[model samples]
Target: MPTIKEIAEATGRGKSTVMRAVKELGLRESGHANPDGARGALIIDAEGASMLADFLTKNVEAKQAAGEGETESSNQPHIDVEAIVSVYRERIDDLKAQIDNLNAQLAIKDNQIKELTCALDNAQDAAKEAQTETRRAHDQVVLMASAGVWERLTGFKGLLGPGSDMDSQ
Candidate 1:
């Protein structure tokens, strides 16, 4: 005889699943006094467990066969191929429109990048020109100072005279 746990282990299923299978297969269970002080225990002989397993296997095979038959019958209904093709065509057109819109956006971005690059180049050229002008002005100031032009313009002769403290330097 096998307990519910032993049958579950043998069948690789839960106790409740084995019990349901036993019930569905109409297998009779023997009643025995519970060693753990419970009322009774329901057990199945080896022959009954084997019969239950066989019955469950046949039942599953039958269900699978019926499911396959149902699918075959369900697929026999007439399908409109033209409608499906038209739906796919519309989807393709929509995807093409999306591609065109993306291309337009990319073109706009490229134009903006080109404009920004041109503006950067112009700013760099202007900066170089400003540096050159600054250097020329500095050279003109040094030349005038060495020639005592500032002192002559201000009428301070002794301040920048040839033998004075400024000339000795």
Candidate 2:
């Protein structure tokens, strides 16, 4: 991370210009947010610093090409290419870390979905078994109701079919 003043100095632009570019790019704050001229410095994230440097490079280059009061020593715009590249690298690393975190969360959610689906299938199987048992019980009731009182009172012998006489035994 770099400060706005550092970027402005490296890019040969005013601090106000760098601050405006920061606002325009819609950069979120990861550093101190004291804008009322507080003692703390407004540090910029790597992404914002890289973008700010790029923006300043183009704007300042255009102005310099117009020959705006430049001696032989001041002909070229002062830009720290190495620093800008470093900022870009930092931003890329940050993005990679975020992707890894999101992938882990996605994996967890996928596991949860698999567990829920298995539970539902098991519940469906249990309900089918209960239905089969209920049907068998209903069939037994129908058979008992159709038989005469004496036959039904015979219990197992009645279930063995009609015309069962056990009186001799």
- Specify the highest-TM-score model's number: 2
- State the local distance difference test value for candidate 1: 0.60
By lDDT, who's the top model here? 2
Name model 1 segments beyond 4 Å from true.
1-66, 70-79, 143-169
lDDT of 2 by residue, 43-94 (tens): 7766677777777777767876876676547545577777677777888999
Worst 10 residues of 2 by lDDT: 28-37
1-169: candidate 1 lDDT, tens digit per residue: 5566655555445678767876666665332212232745556654454555555455556666778856555323233334334434545676698899999999999999999999999999999999999998887567556766666565545544366554554
Off by over 4 Å in 2: 26-40, 64-77, 148-150, 156-169
The TM-score of predicted model 1 comes to 0.40
Q: How many residue pairs clash in each candidate?
A: 0, 0
